[model samples]
Target: MTAKRSKVAPRVATGGGALVPLPVGLSEKEAAQEAYRRLDRRVHARLGAAVGGVSVIGLAQAWGDWASHLALSPGKQMELVWKASRKWQRLAGALGRDPDSE
Candidate 1:
């Protein structure tokens, strides 16, 4: 007796009643390169916007602090001045500048 192998039919029927394989045109390398290009542009744009926002906020805070000092008493004003000077010294040190020299 000869053994017969049965053929499997398509799970889903197409318009022509034929099974068509899914199409994937791009190779792995090409797909990865395309994805990286898109991601890089998106990340760079977001980072630029964030940096700009931080800079604007810093400027606004500095201006507001300066304006509020105008209404302070002489003793209180001096205290604010000392505090600001210390903050400046710390900022300079963080930037690799010598706080005591200049």
Candidate 2:
């Protein structure tokens, strides 16, 4: 007879060597967000400036888009939100898949 495993399975390695698990029923988006947060911390430790620069660029782009629509057409902001949401969803799906399958 063998002993059954009990703890939640860890998905990624943290910088300080901590193990963390995604909840069993996390949605793809939520899981991806969690994974990104975890990975970002590790990446930040290694490439803090580069990560900060890229993040600043992303924020600037988002702010520009929001400001552009905020004046001329506020309704279109919703579209931007959906577009970003879809991009994240795609990212989530990609994260959940077998990387070698592509």
Candidate 3:
């Protein structure tokens, strides 16, 4: 038995490269700087989400563990704090990238 294939022709333009955005009224240097700023903000947003997620998970896990034990678990709690601090440090590093420098 032979199978038939359907053909589609409307997905792409007939003759053109992918579109590139042109910055109106901005010099190339300014456009590059603006693009860098956008990229930096996007990175920061992603890093912020990661930091928040890790912080929440660490806190919830530690709280649940402590609730189950009901005694002092400073060691585990401190460990969670340390991990959260590390995540914050990662976010800080991401924030340290300068969009205007180079």
Best candidate, lDDT-wise? 2
lDDT tens per residue, model 2, 1-102: 544432544365677787678766565656667889979877776775756656666777999997876869756777888999999999999899997888
Error of 2 at 29 (Å): 60
lDDT of 3 by residue, 7-96 (tens): 322121112444345345555555566667766766667866877746655777998996877457777788888999999999998789
After superposition on all C-alphas, the RMSD of every candidate to the true structure, in Å, is 18.9, 18.0, 19.3
lDDT of 3 at 27: 51
Question: TM-score for each prediction?
Answer: 0.29, 0.31, 0.31
**Pairs that clash in candidate 3:** none
Candidate 1 vs candidate 2: which has greater TM-score? 2
When summed lDDT is taken over every stretch of 10 residues in candidate 2, the lowest stretch is 1-10
Per-candidate count of clashing residue pairs (backbone under 3 Å): 0, 0, 0
What is the alpha-carbon RMSD of candidate 2 to the true structure?
18.0
Give the TM-score comparing model 2 with the true structure, all chains together: 0.31
**Any residue pairs clashing in model 2, and if so which?**
none
